[model samples]
Target chain A: MPYTDNTFFLYYNKSVLTETDVASLDGILSKCSAGKQFAYPMADGWYSSAFYFGKGLGFEVTYNDHLAETSIDCDFDNATGEAVTQAMWSYVKDSRFKADANDSKIAAGFNDGSIVAAVTGIWNRTTIQNYLGENFAAAKLPTYTLYKGTADEEQTQLVSFAGYKLMGVNNYSKNKTDAMDFAEFYCSRENQIKHFESRGFVPTDVEARADERVQADVCAKAITEQLKHSKTQKSVPSTLWIPLEGLGNAMITGAQSGSFDLKTQLKACVAAIEKTTN
Target chain B: MGKKRERIKPNVFKRLIFAFKDGSYATRLSFLVMGFGQIARGQLAKGFSYFLFQVLFALYMIFFGGRYVGHLFSGNLGSRLSGERWNESLQIFEKVSGDNSFLILLYGVVSLVLFCVFLTVWAMNVFGSYENDARLERGQELSTFRADLRSLINEKFYIPLLLPPFLGLLVFTVMPLIFMVLIAFTNYDYAHMPPGKLFDWVGFKNFQAMFSLADGAGFALVFLRVLVWTFVWAFFATFTNYFLGLVIAMLIHKKGIKLKALWRTLFVVAIAVPQFVTLLLMQKILDGDGILNKILSTNILWLADQRYFSLLPRTMIILVNIWIGVPYTLLMCSGILLNVPTDYYEAARIDGASAPQIFFKITLPYMMHITAPYLITQFVGNINNFNVIWLLTGGGPVDNVYYGGGSQAQSTDLLVTWLYRLTTDQNPKYNVASVIGIVIFVISAALSLITFNRASATKSEDAFQ
Candidate 1:
């Protein structure tokens, strides 16, 4: 049974960013001052995937019964991925952009008014709401410019990885019938609404989502809007994260401006992800 | 007298021959049946205890330990791999039981260690029986069970006192060490976990993978970089703390300095707080957007910038470590500095020695002679220092150009942290981690042995006195 949408969107200060400014990465970066920065955790694997995935680049992985990766097919090192890498580098090179944002940093930044906007998930909705008070606002991820200053430049909406929480009964459970009944009861629409009311978990059930409280939540609406531009996070190899984190760290550290070859780095990263041992 | 006793001490084979050739009838019988001679001589308590031990060993071998010992010689850890079988009646697949390689290895090691212990006890029983025969031939009065128990409390008190700790060391330290060392020779990794899968003995393949650059394993490259950084960090961490601590201690001990107790108490307060807490606080303060940067009104990435190959973060880590480390040395050096005899300074002053000359010739030499071992220990501890680096940087500001893709090592990682990452990673390579463990042990052992042998403290222990 589905529980809620698990994805990220943009959280901003409405006093600093207008609705039009929140729609594009350029507008947001331009509006952000040195004192009040825009935070995006590009050095993290989970957040860094947005740029590549937004351009339709992804990985397909296969594993044996032992959960060992048998093979992986990935196109994240191709030309499309290079263009996405360039787009990420463009923002990271800006002084107004903070690339090392984490849970604590985001909270501290919002509380001290050092960060005007940040890209994070719904898990932080309550803390951010308390910090921003009436100035709190949310929207789907802004459009990023690709191949800027070139003839083939384009603006595309940043895609995010969406995940779903599910309740399942173990196949070897001693009381399978009871377990199944319990799992179903836990995911029922009324229970889901109760869960949302208590913990701020967005409901997966359509009828439960139509509840007055959920309908008015800016974070829930933003999540729903972001889901339209999201890809399902399934079958991603465990090897993908470390290498991708390295690449993201490199991009944010200005490795792109040097003689460093992005294509070779991406190629090595893909090869590492696909590597298998006997 | 000692030389004569040493000459009389027979080898095991000679003693066994002598026991058999010149033994009484009961002693000869005791060769095949343990404690027979003692039983015939009416040492009921000793004889029965030996007999009981033999019975327990035989039962353990027959029931519990024999199969694991057999499997140890089977080459592969286990023969069968676990899988699932179809159950047509229930329309489901059932899990099939198979040999667990991990259990096989663990039980095998335990059985081997127990066998060694049993052999030692068996040797004691044989020798004890022979001693009983000798006492009878000499027409000496034998100690009864009560006297034997009394003697254990008196003459053998040290044996009872040492036995429990010895057994504990064997079980906890020695057994786990052997298990980890043996894991280096096997393919025990995340993919080959037991029950669902079985790992085989790969024999030295992990070592080769770590040392060979031709295979593109990339471990050799990472090893060299981490090893070099480890030594470099240790040297700087040790010496910086030592010299600065010595200077602070001298300043406090100087005649003109007032509020000496207050200064010492302040430094002691630094030490009172838990080390990890101080390190974590330093981490937050040194962050790119932390309080330090805000105070300076500059956006310098004090600990996160990886440009120029993470020079900023690495240097900041050593600086933060100095903050946490210097106070400990300060406390130690203060005590040692006080103990430096006033007579040496008086003699040096009479000889018209300059301030720098007295310090270099008399003070520095005395300090070094006493603290040589402490310095070496501090050096080795710094090499394995995981807390400061882990808390401050997490071995990060990860430079992909140097570490490459798929490498868990970061630019700031010590070998210990890298080994930790290898074991905790998603695709954990236990064999590789074991190999790194062995390397760290060898390096620490060699360095400590070489330095300790040459150190003035060990070489001339009586010189100062």
Candidate 2:
């Protein structure tokens, strides 16, 4: 049912960040200057989840027919999550790291030569490609050093959420046969290739993905590689985002200053995620 | 004797009883069958119209309204749980329909309102029949249907003039208001959405949650903080705009101020721009990496810094609101300033009063007395001002201490903005939003009433004149 990929990986300027430098967070940050920063929208819930999800923390939400969350079991406040939060705080405090990047901001920053690298999805492919030109490059999200300055420090690959845009025919459609035929035709390999050729949407069909054009795409290859470290976007509770965003915002703002207790903030975030109203 | 008798108007119940007791046979029959007296007295059009309404009410009650009213009175909104059923032909499960609670509540309220309207018409029918009997006793000829139509145009012209708007208010305003108020008492939230699930009335639970300081459900802390900020923001946003506007208008109006029209036009240009466009432009310009920062070569977060309890963003929003709000106030004050009589200034000058004394004794007091109502309205408007704060910061910089943990409130949020976030957030808690809405209404209403009553404009209207 999938039509294209809907997840984020690293988009770096090849001139600023070599392949070796793009392989690690420390390497990327070292190359980034105060003026030309590495953009990561950690204040956003979608992007912030990468840090916790990379450390094997996630949520299992149960939804009823009404699409209401009936129950949620989330482990984003566990010991490992606290360590991940600490590790994020280490680089988030760096002057070269920008934690508030949105799509337009990333494009503008790249166009103005203020951003050397950013973490975002394929939706910004055309704009970033236009801005960076021949220097446009993408790769799987880099490894982050967890629990730095201690014996437990380890280089772990950053995980991301992998989502898909799906084409579906409603069961109650008046012309079910026609709708099904249209859906099939719309998602066919050739049409998907055409779609990618024009709109830059990565096709979901296996044969379509194997096309020469798709294989040549750096974004497509990065997305394929990133999928190994990703979790399916399903089963994420609606309550998760706002609280995680709050947590992410807190990290970027108060983490370096030690104005907030990370453990307490994490506990509160988890509590809010599991909160239910009768 | 007749004049004295006419002066003593009988109450409705007394009139009804007296009509039934002292009326002729036709009037007595009309008590059982509406318009019977009117028809017997040869007012055919009016009588038939009343009879038509009776028949229509009966048909509506029997066919449509009876079911919804019954469901409303039953108190359980709906009982059927939507589920999947086996379909042998399709070889898959198909969704079975269930009672939709939302529609039940909607139609129930509509039926209740219509019943009230029907009762009003029934009272009119009885009263009309009684009047006819009284007219016949005086040996007066009954007015013809054509004469009645003529009266609607001549003496009762206001009826047709007001009817459409009255009906519109009842349907569009009153019905939806009651529906929203009722939602505050119910468990109608994301989890209890209708059609697929049922929401039961949980009276005062949402309100308790809002005010309760219990850990994990401590919205009270957030509410109190936002409430304080709302008041603070309103106080500053209103008065700052007022005084600054007065200053600007007075400066333009001062003697020897060359090219006054040019000054006025410049301010008017600010007003001509749509408010959202201006606010959005301000948002972009004041952003961390925006043009302002680029120009200043500084990395200061104009709208996103939460340090010192979000002093920066809060200050920036109020400052931006002044830019948006001052022009209107300036225009209003300009008109009022011209209206202030020249005699007061002449008298003050003759009395050797300084300019400051003259402004304080004459101009400022006069402006305050005349613009008291405007100030109160502006204050209440500022309290519920959602646009400037929302478009600028989206109530952001996300203060972790109070607004975190799914509070959905932020440092710079007004009650209206927080209420907005509650309803629009991914996990919408509509009941809480409605409760907040009711709170805003109560606050705005009480503040306006108390202030308007005490304002010198209301207290001594003739004193100024």
Best by the lDDT measure: 2
Per-residue lDDT tens digits of candidate 2, residues B1-465? Answer: 011236677897787777777777877887767777789888888888878888888898899888878977777888898878887875555678788778888887898899888877766777787777667667787789999889999999999999999999999999998888888988887778767778877778888888887776658888888999999999999999999999999999999999999998898788788999999999999987789998998767788877777888999998998888889889999999999989989988999999899888889989998888788888998999989999999986776566654567888899999989889876688888999999999999999887867773467654863
lDDT of 1 by residue, B1-465 (tens): 011124567888787777777777877887777778778889998888888888898899999999988877777789898778887875556677688999999999999999989887877777777777667667787778899888889998888889999999999999999989999999999889887689888878888777867567546887788889999999999999999999999889898999999998887687788999998998888876689988998667677776676888889988888888889889999999999989989998999999999889888889998888889888988889989888988887666557753556788999899889889887798888899899999989988886777673467654853
* Sliding window of 10 residues with minimal summed lDDT for model 1 chain A: A252-261
Task: Report the lDDT tens digits of candidate 2 across residue range A1-278.
Answer: 67899999999999989999999999999898999999999878898889888878888877767677677888987889888888887777788999877888999899999999999999899999999999999999999999898998889888999999889987656665677789889988899999999988899899999999999989999999999999889877777777777777776666446565678778877877786443
* Residue pairs in clash, model 1: none
RMSD of 2: 2.9
Report the C-alpha displacement of residue A74, candidate 2, in angstroms.
Answer: 3.4
In angstroms, how far off is B379's CA in candidate 1?
1.5
lDDT of each: 0.83, 0.84
